[model samples]
Target: MIEIFTVDAFATNPFKGNPACVCLSFMNDEHSDDFDQLFQKIAKEMNLSETAFITKSSTSTSTYFLQWFTPKNEVPLCGHATLSTAHILFDQHLSQSNELIFETKHVGQLKVRKLKENFLELDFPQGQPQPILLSETIVEELKQKLCIKSDIKGN
Candidate 1:
C-alpha cells in the first residue's frame, strides 16, 4: 500500500503554493512493471506540479531511491518538490531531525532545513545564465514583435 499525502509547504492556504503528491513506504511493496507510467498517472490524477515516491531502503538509513515527476515531464532537480518532500518526512516521518538529506539528480545531497514561521529552506546549486548575442534576423523579429528597436539580451 502506498500512503499518499498532499503537502502545502511555504503556504498554509490550499492552492496558494505548489502542491506535491508524496507517497510513503509500506511492507512487501514493489512498483508495477511500468513505474514511469504509474508515476505519470499519479501525477495527472493529483494534477500537481510534481509527485514523489519513497521506497524504504533495506540496508541504509540515509538512502532511498527518490524519483520526481512533473505534470508534463520528469525533472532531474526541483527545488520546490525537494522542500515539500523534506517537510513531509520531517513532520511526519522524522521527529528528532529538523534537517533532511535527499540524493537528487543534478542537486545531489540536497538539504532542506526548517525555518521559523513554518517555512522550509532548501539548499541547491545556483544556475548562472550566460549572456549571448542574437543574430540580426532574430533581433529584427523581436523588434517587429515587440516594436522595440533595442538590444535584447539572450542566454
Candidate 2:
C-alpha cells in the first residue's frame, strides 16, 4: 500500500499551518491519462490545500519527480506542499540525505535542506519585479483591509 501522510507546513503544532498531503509512489508514469484523474481523486479525498505526489525520477541520482495538485486541479508550484513533503521525508528517514532535489514539470529542480529537528530551509530562485505604477485602488483596498494594529499597553 502507498503511504500517504498529512503535514502542516510552517507550524510547530498540527492544524496550525496550511496542511498538505504527501503521497509516495502514487503513480508509476505521467503519460497515462488516468494518472491525473486518480491524483485529483486522491487530493479530493485528502481535501487539503494541496497534495504532492512523489516518484522516483530518472533525471538524476539526486532528483525525484514531484507534482502538486489541489482538490480542484493541479498547480504549478506550491511552496507549503513542497515543504510538507520534505518534512515528511526527513522525519521518516525515507530519504538518505538531509538535502533533497525535486524535479518539477515547470520550475525545474528545487532544493531543500533540513536545518534541525522539525525545521527545514527552502532555496528559492531570485526574482526581480519590474517597476509598475502604483494603483490608488490597490492602496485604498490594502488600507481598508490591513491598515495597522498596535497598542503598547495603552502607552
Candidate 3:
C-alpha cells in the first residue's frame, strides 16, 4: 500500500493552515502518462487544495523531485506544500540531511532547512509586486463585489 500523509502547513495547530496530502512512493504500470493520470486521480480523491507527490530525483542522489497537484489541475509552485513535505521528511527520518532540496518542473530547485525540532525555513525565489492604477468605476465594482462598505484605507 502507498503511504500518504496529511500535513497542515504553516499552522501552529493541527488543521489550522493549508493542509496537503503527501505521497512518497508510486508505481505506474504503463508510463509517464499513466503516472500523471494516477496522480491527478489521487489528488481528486483526497479532495485537498494541494497534494504533493515525492519521487526520486533523476539528477542528485540526495535530493528528491516534488510535484504538487490540486483537485482540478497541477500547480507549478506551492510554498506551504513544500514546507509541509520537508516537515514530513525530517520528522519521519526520510532524509538524513538537515537541509533538503526538492526539484520542481517550473520553480527550479527549492531549499528547506530544519531549523529546530518544530521549526523549518524555506528558501524561495524573490518576487516583486508592481502597483497599477485602477479606474474609479473598476474600484467601485471591486468594492461592491468584495462587499466592502467601510472607508478604504491606503497602506
Candidate 4:
C-alpha cells in the first residue's frame, strides 16, 4: 500500500491553515492509463480540497514527480499541496538533501528548499494571466450572486 500523510500547510499548529493529503511512492512505478483514475479515486475517498501524489524519481535522488488532484478532477498546480508534499518529505527524513525538485506535467519543475527554524520555501514559477471574455448576462448573474455593487470588468 502507498503511504499517505495529511498536513496543514502554512501553519505552525494543527487544525489550522489549508489541509492537503499527500501520497508517497518509492518504487519506480509506471503510470498506466488507470493510474490517474486510481489517484482520482483516492482523492475522492480522502475528501480533501487537494491531494498530492509524489513519486521518487529513478534518475535523480533529490527530484520527484508530483501530481495534484481534487475531489472532482486533476489540477495543474497547487501551492499548498506542494508545500505539504515537501513538508512530508522533510518530516519523514525521506530526502537526504536540503533542496528538492518536484517535476510536474503542466507547471514544469518546482523547487522547494528547507530553511532554518523548520521553515520551507517554495520557488514557484509566475503564471501568465489569460484573459477570457464573459457575456454581460453571466457577469450580471455573478455580480448579483456575489453581492457586487460596482461595475465588473472582464476581457
TM-score of each: 0.69, 0.77, 0.77, 0.80
Residues 32-108 of candidate 4 have per-residue lDDT tens digits of 43578889999999999999997656658778888899999999999999999988887776555688888888989
Lowest summed lDDT over 10 consecutive residues: which window, candidate 2? Answer: 146-155
Show the colliding residue pairs in model 2: none
Clash number for every model? 0, 0, 0, 0
How well does model 3 score by local distance difference test? 0.80
Model 3 spans > 4 angstroms off: 27-34, 127-135, 138-155
lDDT of 1: 0.67
Tell me the tens digit of each residue's lDDT in model 3 across 3-61: 78999887889869889898876512211434677888889999999999877766654
TM-score of 4: 0.80
| Tens-digit lDDT track of model 1 for 1-155 | 55778877568888777777787653124333356677767777777878886554443454444568877777777667777777777777675666666655455566677775467777787777897778778877888898996766443
Best-to-worst lDDT order: 4, 3, 2, 1
Q: By how many angstroms RMSD does model 4 differ from the true structure? A: 3.6
Q: Which is superior by lDDT, 1 or 3?
A: 3
Q: What is the C-alpha local distance difference test score of each model? A: 0.67, 0.77, 0.80, 0.85
Which candidate order results from sorting by TM-score in descending order? 4, 3, 2, 1
